[model samples]
Target: MRQAVRSQFTAQRAPWALHRRPFSTSYTRSGYADTLRNLRIGSHTRVIFQGFTGKQATANARDSLAWGTKIVGGVTPGRSGEQHLGLPVLPTVRQAVEQLKPDATAIYVAAHQAAAAIEEAIEAEVPLVVAVAEHIPLHDMLRIHSILKTQSKSRLVGPNSPGIISAVGKCRIGFQPLPCFSPGRVAIIAKSGTLSYETVASTTRAGLGQSLCIGIGGDILPGTDFCEALAAVEHDPDTDAIALIGEIGGIAEMEAASWIREYRSRAVSPKPIVGLIAGIHEVPGRVMGHAGAFTALDEPDAKAKITALVNAGVTMVHHPSDIGEVLREKLQGGSSSRQGILSGLGFGSQRRQMSTVSRRHRTSAQRAVPQQKRHLYLSTAQSVGLLIETDRTIRSGSPAATANSQYLVGVGIDRSSRMPCIIAGHPLDVLSEGHLKRFPFDFQRGPVDIPAEQIASHLGLRNQQTAIDSLSRIIKSLVTIFYEKEAFLLISHLMETDKSLTVVSARFGFDDAAFRIAGRHQQLHEMRDAAAEDPSELEAEQSGIVYLKLAGDDATVGTLVNGAGLAMNTVDALARLGGRAANFLDTGGKATSETVKKSFEVILRDERVRVVFVNIFGGLTLGDMIARGIILAFEELSLTVPVVVRIRGTNEREGQQLIARSGLPLFAFDSFDEAAAKAIELSRR
Candidate 1:
């Protein structure tokens, strides 16, 4: 492993000052059946598709099948017994389940229909269901997740994900570019599909092929999360390590960190984990980047996620390009000091490619993306490869992608020596606030300070006054986009030529909230491509609800609390105690019978919800009213699911007495622990 990585990095960089250390070298191979059985994906797994006859599905199916994947059959309603894409198309998942007995089903239905498709797959007991649609209604996801909790037989990969790909297994369930993945020992689990490819490219470049790669999806609450995927990878003997790539929003990274710590304690020889979170991700409500202009990552959410993983013994790197090198270092026990170039610039050793010069400038490989699209919003290295899928075989005859006259590098352009070079979001404006996560570098409230010499050093260029001036000017324009457009991330490939620097390909990620703000950004809002947006998400916003689907298969309890904070707490406490919550419903402090009835109506919509836990602490609301409402709603909805109510504050005793006299199947308690315990017990029963 050391030799492979060392030689690879050496080939990319110039001579380096040598350092020495000793390390152990050990490796183990994996088998088809024993690997990823929890994820229900393996070498022999028979894969099928839901909505297989749809336009997008058909196109992807063609590409996937051609990539040497085992596609057995599919499910397309009203097309039963029909053949599509040279595979049998059944009318329903149930029919396909009965006949084909596929190991996994990749859902390709539209967002509105994604939940139903997943529910049908779970009902049919398909071992693994990978939902490919993005932005399934939050309520739909909650229902599907609730249904999943009823049984231990089914697992869901995504609702808006790239899906799982096992190069060794020859099973490609999602829509990841095929050329990017290679068969090896590392199982990569990434939140961003685009960044996952960058890691794959990096690891593969180091000659470390992947055993499996699972994109848990970019959704805030995906069906399968990092912890689940990490645990699943743990069971795969062939996977010796993990490349965990996450974005800057949510507690997924933090939770995964907790799991890693616990995992370290249990395993005799734990698999090495290397994590990389390099972008300013845009979640629905929060944004990551800039000073007062952005939701600074200084808030514990972003920084803590990265810090947690690092503290949990995850070898965390700052860039995707460094994943392979760090993985090699960790797997080799880091007892061996690195030999080749210092990997400060990441891009150098990852693929050893500099950048594309202007087409008129050179015949070296060059790709031109359509410049007409207004909002590209590309996430990371992965999104930049959108144009790359078409160019599989190009630019072969070169020592490397780098050029003697051309330098390809990405930098944050700090103020050090007039310009400190770092990398940041889609638009270059990320340098100012992106450093909050790495306070040791720049704890200040502005862009970092570094000299042009440092930027030139990383890119292996001589820092001359003219060159420095040119770079400063170019970087300033890029940085201006952040404040102007509220761009949180920037993905661009820039190359410097004899005349000037040119951007061959670039993509930007503007904050979602920026569009909502009035004034200058309103034009950006107008430029929004509704056709490309997730329809279900738009509908949810129109309903004035902040519903986000969370993923957990063992969650069985349905939580209906008075506020969002309480709803979240109930769900968290339930999970901490080994109880899974079906959905998080906030009633907005209403304790009336109508509110209760409405809540019950929504909760019971998911028939798999075996127990409903009502946790309401009265402030302005009366506990007695809540109890009476619960009883009324129970009778009105004809709900058979057991109810566990924990109400406190005003008239708490009255609420308990009311429930006791109601003679309905409801348990009212003053203690939250007891109520929660009862809910968990009923769910299991």
Candidate 2:
């Protein structure tokens, strides 16, 4: 264990300098509504659609306007002055913004065109802009984020998202089904667009309506995160309770939990908060659906997040459907257990009276009265305080249990080390200003109780005031440890439990290797040996015959493709073929345009690759993405190689068209095998 710990610590510490500072300002909840409110959007906050001529954009625009969105105009570049969905097509955001004075803009453009459209919106000073395109390049996203940050008051929903819906105001700003929601008390905030729709349905079904449902977008770097949304929900008077739907990706949930705890501790009467985290089945290192759903190997997982929230006294549910149920119970219960404990301790109702009376005077005056000074009086009061502290510590799963054992020391009026200490279940309540002063060493909250002895030993104090100071130090230390160790454990567990763990693990390996071998090739046997030694070692070896093994019982679609651009197209085509390509293997710069054939035979050796799609685009290497390799193989082996070929690019117009005109045994298609019929045709032959 010591060796393992040392190795882990050394490995982690060594890379500390190289660790990228996690983008902190990506997610914001407070800025969303605040920016919207600042835009001074009234009944006439007209919106313009950028890609309004397209089917998707037109459909969503029609739905949005029908649902009461003030959509005044649209823009479809070359189709200037044309009308889409009865809205004028102005060709530019500047034209539309000037004419309509619209408060917001929603850009429904393709991923490649998204950045330019967003810039147009910004130039037009459209206060609230929603970009509904997915798969945007990281550099483009960074530029948009940088611009949004500078404007601070302008709101941006997503580069790839479903926008926001405010039920109370009857406003539907994005593409979600507005009929699924009804205005009420619950505010639903989630990272997923589809999941938000599901949550809305569940909440409405459970008889709990929504005040506002915001999908903060599922990108790795979102404009709004959990904590910011929590603040808005916390302040919204119409929102009775908040339903936070988070997935396995970032530390946003954990951060939100800490903030919620802090808020409740200071709040006069805080509302109930319920959380539901998704991606419980996701494997560590494997990305499930959204890019933001990726969890670090050492970060908290869905289960651990749920555990932390539950322990923190936040009503937590594992399923989206259960979120509504748990929230209803919390609401029906009326009182937050946290508030109940605080009130029980006389902090809420009797705080003023308790503070006005000097503690020394109260003690001395009570001692002067013979009845009050009785042994029973002192004994009962002391016992109550001890019991409260013990109960609170036990409930929270306090971390003081992991603290240095030698530091365990108890200080109080009684010399007997066994004197009862009052424990509060919620850590925040116990650490609050009033509670800390009254209980001091006796108060234990959060996971792992701080033993009275540990408190006293650390403080090195003999009196009440010193004990209070000691408790403060202990609280700070415990919080730090919980965030560092406990939070990491939670994220790790979530990553490990995900079904996509293997893919993610492989991806992590690729990323750690700095994407050097991602699109390159390697020899099968040599790659296996290197993988056997250390999977990452294969990245450095760079041997030419790429090897991929499909684990478990899953079927694999073997694809031999040339060039990074064509490789991606082939993989996506395979998905459309009702199959998944096992890996991306590129026979690199070493393979001449003529010698590309050896890569084909090497790719076919793996029996796991049942169907091979040889997709080639003529580049520096002359033949098709797949055909050149096949032609070389036929010349060398003097045999038929069964495969489907889709050849395009460079000289493909002449070569592939000649092959098609020749009516050879090779199966060819100009279009990617949309239905996988071509691959099946060759297999049957």
Candidate 3:
């Protein structure tokens, strides 16, 4: 494969574009993994544990050792002559350095003492130090960062982080749960810890293994930001692709976007970036667990950050589950066509690849199908519509066959409304500027009630019915076919008033829309496993609900929740409290008792799950209804593993009373943190 890619790179040499050569195809697939392994902390580097005698440090150090990290020794304030897990302990970092010559230090000291420990490591000249303590005074962190910026040689990762892991290297530092990560070529750099875990697990399940994963910390002042880590990944030999996980917080994601934009503007071959920002659905000013998670009105937030990155040429994934598949598409040569086009133009490398695969109507038969070209759009907005550009061409299956034609498709969407339409100019240009203000219609504000005559007149159409009739014909044949059972399918055909342009439009369910657009038949086949039992079982699988079954050998904890953000929070807490999540189910709004029972029954079908964690923030779905559903499901499944439940919001009192009378060994709590901690404790048992 390497040789083939090298040959392709050599053969593509347009003499005039020599200086604009993009990367050889092998660079993204294999060369990156090699580079990253060498640039970042290698598996062979020696590691030392600071505050090694503490309980948290001891547990993490043992796990790191079990994972094959090279732990040379340990440092404790007063346990100089003692040992931990058969490793020698020294009183201070200076003495440990003198004796062990360790390459890096993992600090597990208390919050107040974290600053001094970090300063000690820096003064001792350790190459890297990962501080896992939280609650360090703000001033102390400012001082520590200052030392890192000007006075120290050490690179600090976090004062409140889960640390870092090199999957291929088999090295684990900090407290990240090792089972969730797998060895591969992609690397992740995230500000939030649990979210990073979710991404790694997703990547592993998708069969796209990770090279290195870093929880860079969720602090107001992380020692490192996306740019620094990205630069490192860019140079690392072990990483082939990158996933940047951001949240609704500080300007770290924005800064990373700016850096990537600038990097692409100058570099010959830029790495493919999968950018994801959590909290798109979160309310403003509401902090979501992490200390650095508060968003300002003027800050980029999830929407602005996603748009900026998308505009700057990053592949944006709205959910964590999409990271692996998207990365796989780019790595397995799907992105080569765009690179070929860009390299030919002396533009270095393209920032984003244009979709080229045509749609597959279905895959129930075995036969050759003609390829169809498509334009793809990824949005962070809750809903979207589009204005598209299209044309038709004619072809015959055989020389003796009569002439026949198929439509040539080019599509784009208004950034604001996400409406589908046929416009007069380039699709990308139209999308970048959103809808045409002069057209005088907002597809997003409400129903598209503009009379057919008015729309026809605006676009200079001679007759509204003629265009509608033509559009209806196209819709009857192609647009009405449903991809998913619950899909709200709509197809539109449009013609220019001057009779020069024609286009078709469709609105797709957010899930799997990309795959439908890209002609990934094999992936579509894999999605059939998760179909809903029936439409009325809305609570078990609401239209708004999204269930992501993790890819792993075994399942442990299954999350049942009312909101996506809450699901994520439960996962994060599980990781922090030393738990592993096997699957996630988001019930969206208003789930009934029947929905709850059916959902639990579905979860129990997974043999790996030892426990179920339910967190409900009742709104339209009352707490009492949730409690009743749990009782019903508990009786139906005859569940053996612990069922931990957390409930709040409407009918909180009645809900508690009903759960108390269930006579099951079920545990219930009103706090997310307490419930998560208990769930993890039970899962470990």
Candidate 4:
């Protein structure tokens, strides 16, 4: 057992870098997946580590090497003539380039210095660079992009990304968890790092593998987006289908969906695309974990993205676990098999044919059929490839063609009576004598405590919080059963809330399952809306801020920053100085003066906002424009919100002069720390 475990672990270890294929003579970029594959770093591509001595760099380097990544050298400023992990460490990227001429460079540097590291590699003319550092200022990225787009011949993958991996080529750049990947024909492109991993795992488990996986960073503006990735995959000869995982925020998913729609309309044989979008349950104006995951009032969210993709004829997966089964069913043009467990429980082979029997024949064979098992009406997505019919006549011809409308039935036993019952909404009298003789089973007969009796009992003994705590586990268990069986169900359960007996029922299909609590006649849509509204209660209350409204009112310090990183820092600075922020508003980069003024308006709208701090570091943006907006907002609102402004970068002097000369109570500062400290102090008064 020990030896077997060791062998498995060893097999799971990353493969060594593949031998370099001859450099492609043509660098002209193509529009399809082939283009991405053409320039992709493979076994032959030598990689250099920037920040090689750093802990993360060293550890990742080891994994890259173990996985057969051909890492040629390392680069660290002022660390020339050193050695790291038996590789030469040059003082600069230029030196490493001059010596090893590596094809790619992976950056592992602090957020403050990440841009400079990328600049160094670009200056050295490296062909490919994967930037793993995150939290760099927005202005720095603009500058880095300028360098990357012009003077450098390098292609930048990410500044805040997990990187890219190609299973078939045996090359991985970035920090992807590699074991989930298997060499197959499907290509996975995702915006979220963890979501991509989960999807890949699902695909691998379902016997469908991947050709490559790209994590396009969760930032609002990563170096690359879904459109470019999709274009690359379109031309890849090896990839048969594309699996896209997107989250809320940004127009990238919409862009990709639009492109797919056009591609499908034009192409003779368009490849199948299956998509799973996260943040379907997200609230507008609230940011999830990703820095780029903020949904504005008018911008597209998960629902819109899903609708667009589905309209474009993409097979939509409601859950990550369903990716593999969906892909196989869609690509193979058939049904998926999900009856292993049921069959093991002695439910004979799914393909068994019963002789032609009338209603009388079924009655006569009632004793032959097991009385301990129940009948279940199951309907599954066409992509899941499961069609198990029990106690029913089989029709000839393709079953999958009518999969959208056909319902399959499976048999199971009632836990208490040990008698057979059907999950379908029907009367027990319609079934054979196998039923344990349970009542009406009609929709009118409400409040049956069969499927959810344990949940109701458990809730009885628990407080609201405790009951809510177990809700996730129960939901997960329920969802898992559906996924495992590749089916959807409309079922009812009993519950007691507010000491009133309520028959709770839900239609479970897709990710957005609807549920209802019966007051009398059971209004489902209202109950579903009520249930859905609870998740984003804070969002439903406020419409402008990116997160829940911070506590503090009319005299508290509020931060108006241009980037997520700066906003987070300002919040932390206020906390450290014994002040609580009233709200956080990030006016994204490249904002016009009008946009900046609009941002100020949002901050000023907060009733609790007292001392507003505006911090702007304009790299691509003009500080003067931002200053103009602030002055305009102050004049228009005729407000008494004492404001502090700190402007840096391009046109900083002019912006400061405009704010300082304004005959208003606006204060200007030279630095962030000073501005934050003064804002916190002023808020107290």
Question: lDDT order of candidates, best first?
Answer: 1, 3, 4, 2
lDDT of 3 at 661: 88
Consecutive 10-residue window with the lowest summed lDDT within model 1: 357-366
Q: Of the pair 1 and 4, which is ahead by TM-score? A: 4
lDDT of 3 by residue, 146-246 (tens): 44434334677786677877899888777765766788888899876655765786688779889988777766567666777888787667788899887
Better by lDDT, candidate 4 or 1: 1
Maximum-TM-score candidate: 3
lDDT (0 to 1) per candidate: 0.58, 0.49, 0.57, 0.56
lDDT of 4 by residue, 1-685 (tens): 2243223223322121122122222232431222244345567878899999988889888988998889988988889787899999999888898999898888988766787787777667787778876555443454454343333266677766778887777777887766567888788887655556556766787787888777777654566667778877787877888888777755677677778878998989998888866654342334544555644212344555666666677776544456777777878886445421111212123122212111111122222111100012222232122221210111122332222222222222221121222242112222332222221111111112233323323334334434332332233233233333322232323242443322232223211111111111123212223332322223422332343346444438867766443454456456645677776555644467666666666666666777888877653356788889888888787768788888865577889899888888888887556787788878877
Model 1, C-alpha of 203: deviation from truth (Å): 0.8
> What lDDT score goes with residue 588 in model 2?
34
lDDT of each residue in 14-34, candidate 2, tens digit only = 221232232223234554346
| Candidate 3 local Cα displacement, residue 501, angstroms | 63
Off by over 4 Å in 4: 1-39, 335-685
| Candidate 3, position 110, lDDT | 73
- Model 2 ranges off by over 4 Å: 1-44, 334-685
Instruction: Give the TM-score of each candidate.
Output: 0.45, 0.47, 0.48, 0.46
Q: Which whole-number lDDT from 0 to 100 does residue 243 have in model 3? A: 91
For candidate 1, write residues 368-442 as lDDT tens digits: 211112123653343234323323321111122543344333322121111112352222222222321111122
